[model samples]
Target: MGSQKFAVLLCADDSDYVKKIYGGYFGVFVRMLEEEGETWDMFRVSNGQFPEDEKVGEYDGFVITGSCNDAHGNDLWICKLLNLLKKLNGMKKKVLGICFGHQILGRALGGKIGRASSGWDIGITNINLQPSKIFSSLKMPASLSIIECHRDEVWELPPKAEVMARSNKTGIEMFRYGDHFMGIQGHPEYTKDILFNLIDRLLHRDLIEESFAEEAKSKLEANEPDKEARKKLCIGFLKGRL
Candidate 1:
């Protein structure tokens, strides 16, 4: 943990259970993406916590996590995060955006983002990878399964953005703005237990119908995400080894 410091711009609050078991969303992400000798710092950006301007350059990469809020909204913190993303883009710093992070990166890069007409997409999903040299060295499979839970999506990509993958439910399951910026609409950092807990919470709050929750759980039972492959991709991208 002494080399290659990275930052996580967390966009969601921690559930009590998550805090107790996994430390928090920050801890969950660090477990997924961190490597030996790499330091990871988390800023709870959803609560207006962000690294100071001068501190931005101190990290080698940044990760933006999923959020309950819509990426299309104009909340003050979201606005400020967008500004920071723009600055990061200008600096060519490696940045990985996941879920809401995926949509917000699209918006910040001058794309359209809003509620998906296809409604919510939850559970395991198979995304078809397009032929892209960005991941060529990684030998990624033609298709990969991942945990997905989102009601919003990137409607249009920013200028010069390359769509890397798509699923039956999401047109832009993955996209890249440059060598340094990537956006993924699925939760590769999550395990089935986390999604199960999340589904239960959604059902309890009536965010998702009982039937939908049951179906999502069934799907989770039937399939598993390609975690090792995803970890390789994420870590490679962050470390500039790809």
Candidate 2:
């Protein structure tokens, strides 16, 4: 429980809304996981920036963030991110991937990722846990409700990857690729306000129907995500507590 260092490979730029409201995604994530004597640094990988190779070993853990870009896309930055993840895996460093990050990790590790047949899945969803295969140190419930906002999902997991959690909307909601790496399709770092803003943006871009957006918002308002439970899950995994 001494000083610990962590890096966030942020895959998306701060939307104007996020910047003004939550101080950006970095702020959002740090608030969720930061503890005493801990350090958090960020790299905007979506903008083609990354930590230098020599600096990668300094952090105890790395977190990959969500993005608007498709995880399966062949963009230059995305390709570079994939390579970095491969290196992290090779080094056996603790790495947590969220949403787009999850798909990218799956794709990088020889898994199949594509747009979900169910299209976009937004709101709080309950995932069934494979308790036996999961780490016993984790005190998470058999069913977990999390904030979801994604169009793509992992179609097939990489070799040796274990499906730890699944939901009706997605076959692979959460997966663990060895002890050092994990990918979650939902946003554990997101609060209801963040999702609300995101819904507005999606509506403004005409990416989602107004009725669907309203319904999603209503559902989100009706229930709360298991945030503390999620925080415990992410922090425990990163810090070797679970």
Candidate 3:
């Protein structure tokens, strides 16, 4: 038991999608966690290739990233992964979910998720965190702009989940599951350059319309570079009573 490390499970569903969408930002996040004297590991659970039930307890914490697939989609791997998340939450392990991870957390807690109205893909946007003990350590802006590129949002929260943040465009932007789990609907790990790359890929793939892509590109470019602050917020939130 002494040799066991304080591990963090990175639940990755789509390799290509994460590479294309998150790209270098993922590395930045991992490095930030490492800098905090934590030993974390990523588990690429794409296409239902997660470990069997016996191996799940190896992790000390968990962080689920966004996926290209919708939470409501009939993906067996998604369901299984969410089930595992529920178990981790029940055990009161530290867990954080971002974007698609947020939606999956909601689903695992008996909440519902679905496509957004007008099928709008929220790019870089500002989110306001509600006053909570989870954010007391850091002085955050009343409204902070962050990277986001999701078409689905959580419509309802699970029984024990508490809404922690909100945005004008998306009602439920952040949530907390009991005490040990937190989820955000935006990518706090993204830097400006990485966001540019993601927008470029989306444009090249025709996943986003030309007009929206151009607008989003301009907005992200104009936004202030604040990755460090957001990363601090992430660390602070996790360090809070959990």
Clashes of 2: 0
TM-score of each: 0.98, 0.97, 0.86
- Model 1 clashing residue pairs (backbone): 1-37
- Per residue, candidate 1 scores C-alpha lDDT tens digits across 1-242 of 44899999999998887888899999999998887888899999999999999999999999999998999999999999999999999999999999999999999999999999999999999999999986688989999999999999999996799999999888999999888999999999999998999999888889999999998999899898999989999888888887
Q: What lDDT tens digits, residue by residue, belong to model 3 across residues 1-242? A: 33332343344533354466555335645755544445556566544555457766765666777777787876777778877877887778677788888888888888989998847655678888888765665766667777888889999986677898898888898998777778888888766666676677777888888888888887776776456767886675555432
Off by over 4 Å in 1: none
The digit string of per-residue lDDT tens for model 2 on 1-242 reads: 56899999999989898888778999999999898889999999998889999999988999999999999999999999989999999999999999998999899899999999999999999988887444456666788899999999999986699998899999999998889989999999998889999999999999999999999999998998888888988999888777
Quick one: how many clashes does candidate 1 have? Answer: 1
